[model samples]
Target: WSPYKLLTVFTFIFQTASKDGEVRLVGGQSSHEGRVEIYYGGQWGTVCDDNWDISDAKVVCRSLGYSDAVTVLLKAAYGAGSGPIMMDEVACTGNEASLMFCRSNGWRRNDCHHSEDAGVICKPNEDESGSEVEGTTHVLDRSMDFAESLKNLYETRQFCDFNISVKTNGKESETSIICTHRIILLLNVDANFMVKDGAENFTLTVDEECTPYVDDFIRYLYIKKISVTLKSSKCIHKLASMYGILELQEFCSQLFTQLLPEDLSFQNQLSLYSYALSTQDTMLADSCLQYLAWNCKAFAESEAWYQLTWDQLGNFLFRSDIVVPDEFFLLEALESWILKKGPNSPDLDKALIQMIRFPMMHPEQLFQLQFNFTLYKSHQDLFQMKTLEALEFHTVGFQNLNQYVDLSNIDYMPRIYTSPTWSYLLSGSSIYNQYNPYYRYDYQNFYSQLRSYSSSFHTPKHTSFLFQSDMIQWSFAYYESAQSCRNSGRYCYYDNYPVLLLSFESRPSSNYSIQYQNKALMICKDSYVSDIRDFKNNLVVLPSNDTSSYTFPCSSNFSYQYVVRPLYYSEFQNTQ
Candidate 1:
């Protein structure tokens, strides 16, 4: 018989195939070592050394249901000298299936029979059982053990009905069956309970009854209550404001560390920072600023620019005690100065000279002083003087000075001839004429009358008293002319003529009566005069029965000689 046949029979008798179809280790061995003969195709052979490591031994041990390999031996460690050795010297690394298939260095050709073989045995350790009793039920607590058991049961989806039996002097005293999905073993006292296959030996007693556990429901209720409270509280605004500026910055830092762009705008960033500042929360503002300073280049630039601008403007506004209104005026003046003096002007002193020479001159003339005292505090004297000097020689004509003058009077024309109301009226008239040209004659007559001096024309005694009655008449005429031109869809041609009238007759307390040709046309206050043309003879009477009448200047040769009647307190109130 062949040596392989003899070895095969021996292996079959010693190691039966496990359910996994592998020869399992049988007794006393913790690892596989020493080449053991294997039977292959009715021949005995040795496995040679090839690729091998502890991992191979591990596979071998686990194949037999042994936990793991503890050791591995290479070469012939068992014995030496044998027959054809089936295959010379036996060499098997721990990784190979058996001694027969391993590669050999002519060692398999040697005639060593009993020496070249591999073997292994089953050797069990306490750890292999996967359990250890750490304490007894008498003096040791079982809470930790029970907790672990509960975790295991929960993970495995096991339903548990624990029956507790209290024994006194080796006799059952009390019994209770508690059904649960999982039990939390608490510390303290002694208790015993029965489970599915084994009675659990518990040493700790649970004083409180187990409550139903619904993780999702509990979490939902908690979150809903918190959300409702937050929604109802006014403090939420402050809290949210705090977090938007403070927490968001911190979160962005860690989240977008590498993705932030390089060329962000400073002005955009200031909007957020300024909001944070306005919240009156110093901590939030400080945090936001710190983050901005660290992460955004634009923020740093904006902060620096703001500091410089504030230092320059703040000194003038606060230190000089310039009133808030004048500060705005000064800014206007500065804009004008910049336009004329050139933005790159080396010295502001010359620029101020130009500012003071024209626009400032009007205010000066009107107020009879170098500065308008009503516009600024007393402490602003020197600063105002410096500003005036800076603007004097920098601007052109009287334009800058007229900007500061209050021109409600036609007699008080600034050299610039530009007044706020007049500027608006002229612009509107220009637009109106672009669409209508029929009013050219009317405009010419009005300009001639405005330029001419007529002592017979009614003029208010007080320059401040605006003429209301004349304004109403002018308004009625302008509205009619504009309507006619616009209806014709042609150029109005009244480029310099006023298209709207400011009514002084509509004053709250003015008790004027409207009449046509010495006959009452409409009662005055709290009533509407729908159409003035409805009156006969086109004559309107005043509140006094003095037969005083006014005529439409446009009726006679398109005349523009209109009167300026004095305004009463009631007239101003009605307009307002």
Candidate 2:
């Protein structure tokens, strides 16, 4: 029978005969719409259905092994019923029936109750194996094993491949055959089958229930999960490696740059430059040094440089070395740039002053020039006097008289008109007057005698001053006279005195004013002062109309004294 007929047979048996708790078989059909009989209580019966169609008859005929079915009928009772009808008023269409028995709609409507419900039965051709058999027989019985049965079926059917084997009850079962690459018929067996490796297992099933496709679906899931995992791990590793390398480079570069500037300060720029030039990885160091040079030069010319001393430079350089090379180079470059900008710039002068003290050949000339200017301004008069004294006292050292003296310029000799010695002489005995005579003197003879005496003596060429014991003693003896002359009056009379005097007048007291007397003192805190010679006693306070001025004496020991009188005023007012 066709597979559709077999399915109809099973469905009919499950729906009709099985519901009655009996096992019965239905056969002997002719057309697709064939009559079906049921045996109940040892009597054969027919079923009648009013609502019936060719589709219902087809199912009945196919279940009974007929080729096809055409029509179905229904009635109150089966027509010509001589036996007991299991169910009357059977309702069916072409879709009803089973190979076990034709199905009937139980207890349906009836027009005439006296007529027996009857159904027609037809016989198919005797040679047509599609016809139903009379009684129960072993239709599944076969001598061939399961494998042989499956092979025979596959040979008979061009659309099937019986590659699988079935074993039942310790013997091969001839139960079913499967179509290749399509249906997998597992007959009454509970066992897993393995498809060959690399072969695509498309479908998996157990007892006709579809399950997961074996090869492609499972492999796709594994591949997708694994691929994602591998890619994420690789990305994380790559990122970690990149970050670690970058951080290492940054740290190394920082340290390298910091050490470079010190090499420059030590006049080892060439060594540092060569080291950087030789190393392929010294780009950071090179850039740093170049920047340092430029910045430091700029800083040297700025006002901030002037405020910075050598000690401060040492501290800054030491601290900067702790940073990375790149940072160090950038900062050094900025500093060098500042230095090069010059002293008028902020702090540049102070920095240059500190660096100038270092004994380096390149900067020595510049240092000397600056030193010369400062020294000239600080001691210009002393130098001038020394020069004049050297020329006068050492005239005889020159053998050439014309080169040593200009006799024609007699008026050039300093006259005694403003001399303190002359003033003293005028106030003293008359013998000083004859010795001084007039302002006129024989400068030619004096210059000739001085030259002759100096020519007879010998001294070092660089030594401009002649040291004499008598001259020293005489200068020391007149020290108190010089000091007295300096403090004698409001205005200083001695130009040679080192000290300068300044005074201010106190205001007169008034009835509206409150007078409180106090004193202010200025103490030298520096260690340089050892005596009054090193001290500035020039700052003085004097009472109005008084000749005497208060002086704060210099002392090595701890001492305090009143230096200035109280500040006095007629009235107090808030200017702010």
The top-ranked prediction according to lDDT is: 1
**CA RMSD of all predictions:** 40.7, 54.8
**Candidate 1 lDDT, 378-494, residue by residue in tens:** 225544664454244223223343355322322121111112211112122333444434333464466211111111112122112122133222222233333453554534443
Relative to the true structure, candidate 1 reaches a TM of: 0.17
Could you tell me every candidate's TM-score relative to the true structure?
0.17, 0.19
**Cα lDDT of all candidates, in order?**
0.30, 0.29
- The digit string of per-residue lDDT tens for model 2 on 235-315 reads 222222222332223223333433433332333333334444444334443444443333343333334443433433443
> Cα lDDT of model 2 overall?
0.29
Weakest 10 consecutive residues, lDDT, candidate 2?
A: 448-457
* Candidate 1 deviant stretches above 4 angstroms: 1-236, 245-381, 390-576
